[model samples]
Target: MNLLEYLNQNYLMLVPALWVLGFALKQTPAIPNWMIIWVLLFVSITVGSLTFGFSYEGLINGITAAGVAVLGHQMVKQALLGSGSRKK
Candidate 1:
């Protein structure tokens, strides 16, 4: 099942935006590794609310966007890194 189906079409753009923001956060010295997700979520929520007004659907879409961005990053990362087993 595509998790993205639950998100609004308008919110789809936010996924990539969040990903880029997360990447920037990772590169920053002050952000720290653990806080990156929270930062992304906060930005996503704010963006959603601003776009659609404050409401349950807006909040849910924000959450879904953040989730998709993080999940996509991790999936790609795992594919490239493998399961921690390297053959020399």
Candidate 2:
């Protein structure tokens, strides 16, 4: 298989996995929403730039991915922790 095909295959798997991972990260102690968003955003952008060769959309895609990840993490966290309030 060619490099592009190999990358596309992995990207398909990774996108969903990243969502799961973002939620997992939320379970950790003191995992700020901002940090999670930034990290995921940076990773997605880096991947897009390297994989699809998006020159300008690199920043935009990165921001969008990060927002999506953060929102997903927040939803998962709320589901698990009950409206984001810490259980006493």
Q: Which numbered prediction scores highest in lDDT against the true structure?
A: 1
Could you tell me every candidate's TM-score relative to the true structure? 0.92, 0.53
Report the lDDT tens digits of candidate 1 across residue range 1-88: 7989999999999999998999999999998899999999999999999988999999999999999999999999989999786777
Worst 10 residues of 1 by lDDT: 79-88
Best by TM-score: 1
Cα lDDT over the full model 1? 0.93
In order, the Cα lDDT scores of the candidates are 0.93, 0.61
- Candidate 2 residue 26 Cα shift, in angstroms, is 6.8
Candidate 2 per-residue C-alpha lDDT over 1-88 given as tens digits, one digit per residue, 9 for 90 to 100: 2222333333444456568767676687778865766667677778767866776655555555555555555667689988558666
Provide backbone clash counts, one per model: 0, 0
* Worst 10-residue lDDT window, candidate 2: 1-10
Q: Candidate 2: RMSD over Cα atoms?
A: 8.0
